[model samples]
Target: MDQITNDLKKSLESNDAYCLSELSTLFSDRALTDGPHINEDLNTCYGGVLNELHNVACLNGNEVWTSGDKDNIYLYNLKGDILKDFQTSSTSCIQDIAVTQSGQLLYTDDNNRSVNIVSNTQIDTLIKLNEWIPHGVCIASSGDFLVAMTSVDWDHTNVVRYSGSTEKYSIQWDDQGQPLFPAGYTTKYLKENKNLDICLADPDARAVMVVSAARKLRFKYTGSSSSITLKEPFYPSGITTDNYSKILIADMCNQIIHIVDKNSHFLRYIKNYNLRSPRGLRVDSKDNLFVAECYTGRIKKIQFYR
Candidate 1:
């Protein structure tokens, strides 16, 4: 761990973007060389109901949040123990969950077609669109909220930006005036890269769409056919970006997590880690990865950064 910290410090001192990018690959190689092994008994969190787990997010250093198919969202310790659970007052499945800049919890209320925010002991409606249904909710690095929304027919999908309840921006079309994303109800999970680019996982499209901070089309990453780590017909689900701009995508069909750089270049596959249907992913502040498995209802904590 000390070595990894020192390497990152040195890379930051150089102030070179290329050096930083190279460090991400170095981290991946080190983990692979050391034979990434899951400390099964030590890192697994297993208090969720069987086959009920849906999504997960890192709330803080000590707390990880998970939502199930029911109306409950649970907070658990790093070890396998339930700390607490909250009922959203609606029985519909919570599509996604995220933590706000002020330490508030945010989630998609699919039952009401709105984005809900939990602050202090009160859950309030943060953004409620009239005709649009919210799927994924994320707090941008700039402290604003980014939500993936779609129409009822799922024929149109786009991301909406909101500063509290007021609309700020909308990202829909590409640079050439084409639809930026394929119409689907599932292309929602999104995160802001270290460079402020928007990265989203589209399960229906089997691709990850990356857009510039200015809402311009940057690149689209389909799975690499030549790579042995990643399989074809990529069905990406939950997506996240670490502090180093490395994107972690959950491939549900392949049952593996693909790590990529800021440019959407393939870095490595986090395979052979005993993962089954990894649906939700979150990298904590200490670079510890928390993965939620849909089938087993377990959250696995891994030390990939070291």
Candidate 2:
């Protein structure tokens, strides 16, 4: 343990990019805690400004960016006040939205087949694909962009990694040469776990698929039948991970959030919060979860961990 700490300190002092997965492994014992339990509700931001809220991205500790079936994105505070409203470069609605570590907003425009970044009200096109339509996007700890895309014909789907508009690689198949994600125009949301695992919520498959940093198949969580409160089919819509590497998935059909460990072990279900069609999820630095309700058009703030 001392040696590992010394090595991490040296890497930090040198200002070089370090592997978060290695750190997570080294500190797994210390990071592990009791099962997560929900605390009192913190706040709720009314998203009625949008016709139907679909996605929510944490901008900072006190602010979040929201989008619906429109080309505009609104930034709101915990008090439900709009801080700023920005429109996408294309007239199409935003498929998904994510915030970078540096606080910049990134969104996907499937209609234009482009990925754009919003900085100080100026929208710049970062990536433009020919046959693939961008659906969901998230920023990895390595400063790379992981985008979920569907083919032009909507028959195939995959996740691609990009570094400043340059294609790095893609994760589409498993070791057995089978497609990892379901096909068609289904909504697929993804995020990078603290262990450097790519976690995706696929509603069509009704499962949460996770892949290691090496792009190997880790596990697939297809909802638990033991839970009496969870509805019949598990419909995972949005996904996010906390500092402890716990995967939080939004179950759209059940109207609850499912919590799982890094190894795909079912932890618990958050069903007490008056969740109504929880579609998108985002966790702040403090593990505060922000859930976007599709029908209610509201963003609820939840504290599920100490």
Candidate 3:
């Protein structure tokens, strides 16, 4: 394992993509939990009324909102009490959900390719696309909606910004006019880092793609290489950013979360505590990490900071 780690480090330093790919393929079958795990323990695990939770959003660091395919969106308090249950517009499935700075509930309807907001009076469509499907939704620091959308064939993907139903900016093709992200149906979860850069997790590409505040490509971080051979592919699902600008991403297949610094340096893996297919991830203002375990229908609130 030590030798393999050393080799991976050398390969990374040399920018050897072929060597890294071969290493990943060779180790992609060991039990995902076999490697070194973090020592942090989950503060609480809440179950009941949650099934196939696809995403989570935190409001004021106390209230939590969970979305699923059950035709309902759930809101819960820190004590695990269900505060509200709001019905969705369709039964197909809610692709993603987010909480705006003003406390409004915003979500993407996958079946309708629409973005809606739950206001004090009613649910209304903020925007609807005819050629693309919305996969993930988040509120930027500037109070605009950052939505991840892809074409029907999954041949093209883009991050669009909407300011109250009007298009503001877009991030798709790079400066070279080439596609910036791989095409796929996988949901591309995204969030704004503390420094205002957009951090995106692309499961199809098995990598995290970062874009600068000015909408330029910053960097792309693939799964970090390790001495301990891995048994499965690096499938990043849910993604969020902490106050420190650390990017935390859920590795669904690997059953772990990868933590990366602001500059996109691989820091460490948060494992242990028997995380099972962890998905929807959010870091509260207090730095508490909330993880949604998909298959188990449970939410694990963990304290990653001392």
**Highest-TM-score candidate:** 2
lDDT of 1 by residue, 207-248 (tens): 899887667767888877456744557888788888777889
TM match of model 3 to true structure: 0.82
For residue 89, give model 1's deviation from the true position in Å: 2.7
lDDT of model 1, residue 177: 84
RMSD of 3: 10.6
- Who is ahead in lDDT, 1 or 3? 3
Could you give me the TM-score of model 1 versus the true structure?
0.85
Judge candidate 3 at residue 170 and give its lDDT: 82
Ranked by TM-score from best down, the candidates are 2, 1, 3
RMSD of each: 5.6, 4.3, 10.6
Instruction: For each candidate in the order shown, give its overall lDDT on alpha carbons.
Output: 0.76, 0.81, 0.77
Models 1 onward score TM values of 0.85, 0.87, 0.82
Best-first order by lDDT: 2, 3, 1
**Clash count of each predicted structure:** 0, 0, 3
Tell me model 2's lDDT, rounded to 2 decimals.
0.81
